[model samples]
Target: MSSSNKIQKKTKSIDATKKLAEKIKKQALLKQKELQKSSNQDADADADNSTTHTALSKATSTSPVSSTVDPDAQLKFNTFAELKLVPDLLEAIQQLKYTKPTPIQSEAIPYALEGKDIIGLAVTGSGKTAAFAIPILQSLWHAQTPYFGLILAPTRELAFQIKETFDALGSTMGLRSVCIVGGMDMMDQARDLMRKPHIIVATPGRIMDHLEHTKGFNLKNMKYLVMDEADRLLDMDFGPVLDKILKVIPAKRTTYLFSATMTNKIEKLQRASLNNPVKVSVSTKYQTADNLIQSMMLVNDGYKNTILIHLLNEFMGKSTIVFTRTVAHAQRTALLARILGFNAVPLHGQLSQAQRLGSLNKFKSGTVNILVATDVAARGLDIPSVDLVINYDVPTDSKSYIHRVGRTARAGRSGKSISLITQYDLEMYLRIEQALDKKLPKEDKPAREILDALHIHVDKATAEAIRQTKEIHDKRGNGRRRKNYDDDREEK
Candidate 1:
């Protein structure tokens, strides 16, 4: 054929390819629209109004419910009974005393059970673990497979918490879950893996370590991949580790990505991890829960400690989490609270894994009612007993503020959060308010009167707490240096 004839043929082939591409895009969009419409329909029929739930108002005096119900009111699930969950799981839910589903659970569980990819955007303490755990358990109830699901979390504590949830919900089914995280015994984790467990709850780095080194262990047959607290995972610089896991996992598996906030990194992760996902965003705005009563108290430059002490005394015997900006601050504040006769514990990255877990367990078990910590405990662990969260130190940003306050007001429970703001925290406080799109309520009581009621004296207790904090800090620093020296010598 002539050159002109060949050119005409190539151009016609190009046109055909373009037409096919357009058709595929149109089909995908239509499918998305259909899924969205169905989701809207689900929302219309099954939605639960958590803000107005009786559970949240049992003790508050004449608490008024929001007059406006979301237009998607029909999509909420009022109770666990309405979810069509398996009988065993429902029994477990009842045993756990979960009468109603939080918004995230109400919305995400249905789609997850259908084996669709999902991106659940909810605040911390929004019952996201159950949203994924229920469906995974329901799928694995009768599966003879060794590992049916893989749930990834940013921190070991979060991973362990997920594992506990899985164990509780699947207890009747005799299902098992193995936790893979750093700082734990690798051989023990390997032994657990050898048991042919049905679920694997792990952190990204440790999971990669096991996948690369552990013999005869793989997730090739895994059916579901869940990245809980996905935003914090990426923010912690686990992107490369996540990529490695994705490459090894089966391409046919369903995925559920849950996060408290959305960022550029989270969006990219969603694109890389999910396929045709249904986005379930219960919290589009960077705001705390409707059940959370947030307030801020302005303090003089040197009076934050005094205010914090007063507040802790005011909320004595209640489950409270006190967030400090630094590990040293957490330690000092916790020691001070202890000296003040409050049952307090400290949680920070500086502690050993066992100690961190022990601290958390103590807080959860009510052995210790006050938990002092840095941002490490801010994101994903749910403690329903936390009725109050005191920002001993104001958060550095809006995202931190959201997560910090989220430690309370969990699972549709009414809770209160107060931030101690000084002149230095004013700028960050303003940014937080702007991010939340509303001004926090100011404390109604006068500062002098509040302090007078508490009658706190900081002379001896404060000095001793500061001294204890310094001693602990020095020991940790020295231990780290010793480890480094030992490692260097071994390499030689």
Candidate 2:
């Protein structure tokens, strides 16, 4: 209470804060070293090693990753099937052709099924879906009442993808599930709430919308609550919405919070959202398998599209995702790729739910080898055998770079993250590198060979005409719709 006491406490607190960050940094550095070391070994082995699996062989260069075995866990346990999965869920898993429990599933399911709140620290495509979904489904099977399960994802793509996971696992039991997110019919979601569905996978904003607008859409019976990508949801400032949902929903529900990185803010969010908790971590930060061959290239601002096109051609026939900064950028990149004769598609927030689903399905089915997406389209949507993740626009931050690269090299698969940096992108590139704690290798002309693969060689005059027309359109002539109103006004 005295100033002297407060000063001493403050000094101690600063010291403690430093210690915590250092602890996290040290743990992160250690894991990163492991991944880097493994990557070095894998890279030394083959240029075309599959990015998603551990069974690495030069012969299976075209195969999608089949499995990723955690070395640390192998010492303690061999497979996920060894874990005591409840009968019904195990049957469901078998039907889905899942032969083994992924690392997250193996680690998280037991404690979660025991009714322990969980903090799952794992990367995207690390099988975190099954980690939480299996336990929740198993719990649902035993409950007498049709209590709702609530899941909050950071993006519409992730929310919908989570719904798909639930749908797959719960289909046999007739457990109905719905995904609620922005850019969709909120009123329809409100109507669906009246149906008393067993699970609702949603983004924070729309879920909050339903809670605020719908009558008798009570979450008082919500028995399971999950916050996927907790850091991003919190970073995007969904805290108020998350809190409002918490305030209105039953406080006694079981909670699960997951994130790739455990920042201080994430810690506070967990404290706010979770009860007594169990922690399940597959790998510490940067502790991924050492098979990813990450690199970066620098280009001029005007030549960004040219560079991205070259990379796509160079890596042609490989399933890949390009992370663009905005929806417009995604569309531009997709258009350019298509114009140049690449089988590419755009995936972004502006698209309808049907389009989003269609794009991802096309990519997954390998009908389209290149998918361009905004950050919203990047998270939690798993498409197998993606060999490369190109940051057409280098991520504004490191977390995004991680999430972007994570789309590839999933499980034990070897993958690569290629960043295209221009002069304007220098600051952002440095920030990403700083956060990632590394520097990129500079390549002189990575684009020359890839450019040769591009088939769009139109004359300058033809391009000028199209560019002029586009410029005119961009100035808001045809894009705007004229609204006509009746001259007569009548009182209601």
Candidate 3:
């Protein structure tokens, strides 16, 4: 009986040990999840809380006369609903699921609805599209006025997006907006123009082509002029063409300029193009979307690839867009990433239109997880949700950075922008920060120990490199490592 009791006690001891091991494993998993939550770039830590009112709602709160010398002076808006939009327009807004007005809406819509000139400094996706789009629809509603509204966009992609937004809002109304942009069907656009659309959303180059090629293209009744991305347009050589178009346009017409940033170029164009106009900006300083958390990484040219590899190892499964400075850089980065077994793709202007569209569609659908792109594909792109924007190359200037980072942190969703700065980019980095007027936090390189923990597999060449590096360090005996493994191996 004593022996049997002793055996039972030993068995119980084994059982307790097993239970303790299981408990420890579960605890480790929970801690890992917590660590991941803390480390994720887009951890739902912030969101865009600034879009108070949609365009018309935003517009109505402003005073007609300047209350102060500052253009940002607050104006009184009774409400955007006071703009007296057609019932069908309201229904369309409701169908699009917009319940209330944006700030720009409250301020600009009332004046615009009254057929007054306006200036809008709202950010992209701040419902600026709808701010002008709604007014355009309201102004053209049941009007006998010719050439309903003329709105110019900076990029073909943006032109198409604006037309799409309009289509959704005008589904119930008797209005049609034709898109005129580069790279697709000019003759077809000429044919579209023959229909005499109440509104024309066009890129400058294509519109100029239509003006040069198509006869009887009169702006006799063109009552409204809108520059969707005013700053970008004036920044490009589109200035001369736009200036000429403005000359042909009816001088007495009302005008509106909407841009993410109002650069000096925009100011020059505004003075040249817009009369005493109403201006509104969401924030005094142009920033990454309110929801985006921006950080910076410093690397040498040779280290960029290894750092990116390490980042991917850590960020496993998240969608990321890396913005390179040129098409060749985009192509090379995409290929290198793919060769490294990353789900990567290249999207740039160098591809045929079909190819560009195809790559975008694949990335959007999650077939390809990472996209290396130039600014051409970056504008007016609204993916379902972008997890990160990496400036593989720091932008030429702050405006470029704004547009690139704007690719993420859209609507009310959260995102992040990481600038990869190489030694060569030092000067450009300072300029970018100077333009931004905000200091970027420098993040330490990710923990290499974590890479080992995750069992990351590097190329044979890379592995050989790491081995040689450790050997040299071990020889130096700087005490970073625990011991000189090479010496130990030799003694063995």
> What stretches of model 3 exceed 4 Å from their correct place?
1-83, 144-146, 364-367, 449-492
Q: Which numbered prediction scores highest in lDDT against the true structure?
A: 1
Query: What is the TM-score of each predicted model, taking all chains together?
Result: 0.80, 0.76, 0.73
**What tens-digit string does per-residue lDDT give for candidate 2 at 201-314?**
888877777777888777888899998888777776577777788898787888888877666786787667777677776665654335777888877675566667667767
Model 1 TM-score, all chains together? 0.80
**Cα lDDT, all candidates:** 0.82, 0.74, 0.73
- Cα deviation of 161 in candidate 3 (Å)? 0.8
Task: Please provide, for model 3 over 179-275, each residue's C-alpha lDDT reduced to its tens digit, 9 standing for 90 to 100.
Answer: 8866566678788898888788887777877877897787778888888777777776677888878888888888988777777786677668777
Q: Regarding lDDT, does 2 or 3 come out ahead?
A: 2
Question: What lDDT would candidate 1 get against the real structure?
Answer: 0.82
Using TM-score, give the best candidate's number: 1
Q: Considering TM-score, which of the candidate structures 2 and 3 is the better prediction for this target?
A: 2
Taking the tens digit of each residue's C-alpha lDDT, what string does model 1 give over 223-311? 99998888777876677778888999999998988888978887687668777687887666596788899999888756677778877
Candidate 3 residue-wise lDDT at 66: 30
